[model samples]
Target: MESIAIFVDVQNVYYTTRQAFGRRFDYNALWAKLSQSYRIDIARAYAISSTDPKQRQFHHILRGIGFNVQLKPFIQRLDGSAKGDWDVGLALDVYETANSVDRIVLISGDGDFQVLVERIQQRFNTKVTVAGVRSLTANNLIQAADDYIEIDSDLLIGQ
Candidate 1:
């Protein structure tokens, strides 16, 4: 079986899916679907700590599904804007873990990762599968990835 790693941008996916489909992502279903064809060497989900009971419960649920839930401190600026992004962290993790896995499955629609994806594929010779909601995902990212998995109804937790 091929070795694989999964990196999920929790906030991006959560917001995008909620806005586009009015539902939650089904991680249980995703794990089941991916495990059949690959030996998942890494399954990490990046999230911002909100300290909400529901958010904590969701993090626990991700752990139950075999993901290493990484949390970043949520920061609210004086300007009334919030800052909590795991793009750099996620990229670093992917870069460091590249040698161990044969393929990477990045679950985010952020276009900023296009260069990183290209670099990983070119330098490490790894296959990158970009999974995101079609309408929300960046065109450059979709084109750069070795494969793209469109997020649809099947991957949603609830309607």
Candidate 2:
């Protein structure tokens, strides 16, 4: 079986799915679907740390699904904006893991990751599969990826 590394941008996915489909992404379904075809070497879900009971419970659920839930403290700025980005960290990890894995699966619609996807594929000769909401995902990102998985009802909760 081919080795694969998975990275989930939890915040991006949550917001995009809710915005586009009014539903949550089904991680379990994604796991089951991918596992059949690939040897999952590493799975990481990046999220913002929260004290909310629901958030904690969600994190626990992700852990139960075999993901390493990485959290960064949520920052509330005085300007009324908040910050909890994992782009840099995620990019670094993916770059490092690229050589070891045959493919990298990134779950996010953020256009910022386009460069990272392109670079890793070119430098490491690794296949990059991007899974995101088609309506919300950037065109450049979709073009950069080796394969694109549209996040539809099949990948959403209660579908």
Candidate 3:
């Protein structure tokens, strides 16, 4: 059987939910739903590590939750700018895994992923879906996705 790959941008989901819906993310619940939909042979969460100890612990939590965690250290530019880019990592992983997977599930709300989604579908013929909360997502992103799941309800209760 062909496998599925799940790529999550954790910070993006958290900030979008906090800013738009005010609901705390239930990652376990979300993961359950995604697994139910796809074979999910590879699961990854890309995160940035700051000086804070909590960030390190969060990375562990992700590993404990059965995801391959990729950590990028937070870099501060001399021009008084902070930089952390998970998009590049996410896209590269998706591309690398696309040939092996039947489907690619991206757990993020960033509209910027539209291009990557398009490329994945056109090149690999992989079914691409953007699983995100309703009303908190970009229209263009949804349009670009081959399929979409708007997690607007209590999908956490094994529903």
Candidate 4:
């Protein structure tokens, strides 16, 4: 069995799915589907920390599904802007883990990850699968991935 690593951009997926389908991404469903074929070695979900009870519950659910939920403080800017992104941290972790795993699965629609995907493929020769809402996902990111998984009804809650 090939070892695989999974990375989820929690905020990106959350917003994209809500905006595109008005539904939530089903982490449990994703885990079930992947476990059937891959030896999952590392599964991490990057998210912004919040004190909301609902957010806490969501994180707990992710943990129950076998993910190590990494949280960064949500920043509120003086200019009414907010900043909380895991691009750098996620990329670093993926680069470090790429050599050890045969495949990597990244769940996000962020175009910023295009470079990371390309680099991982070139440096580690590992297969990279990207999962994101088709209409919202960036063309460059999708093109860079070794395989692209569309976040359709099958991966959405209440579908």
Q: What lDDT does model 1 reach?
A: 0.95
**Weakest lDDT window of 10 consecutive positions for candidate 4:** 115-124
Worst 10 residues of 2 by lDDT: 150-159
- In order of appearance, the predictions have TM-scores of 0.98, 0.98, 0.88, 0.97
Which ranges in model 2 have alpha carbons more than 4 Å from their true place? Answer: none
User: Tens digit of lDDT per residue, candidate 4, span 42-130?
Assistant: 99999999999999999999999999999999999999999999989998999999999999999999999999999989988999999
Candidate 2 residue pairs in backbone clash: none
Error of 4 at 91 (Å): 0.9
Better of 2 and 4 by lDDT: 2
Give a tens-digit lDDT track for model 3, residues 1-159: 447888988778777766666665666776777667667699999888767888788778778878899889888899999988799889899998988889988988889889899998999899888988768788889999988888664632222
Compared with the true structure, what per-residue lDDT tens digits does model 1 show for residues 53-133?
Answer: 999999999999999999999999999998999999999999888878999999999999999999999999999999999
Q: In terms of lDDT, which candidate is stronger, 1 or 3?
A: 1
Candidate 2 C-alpha error for residue 90, in Å: 0.8
How does candidate 4 score on lDDT? 0.95
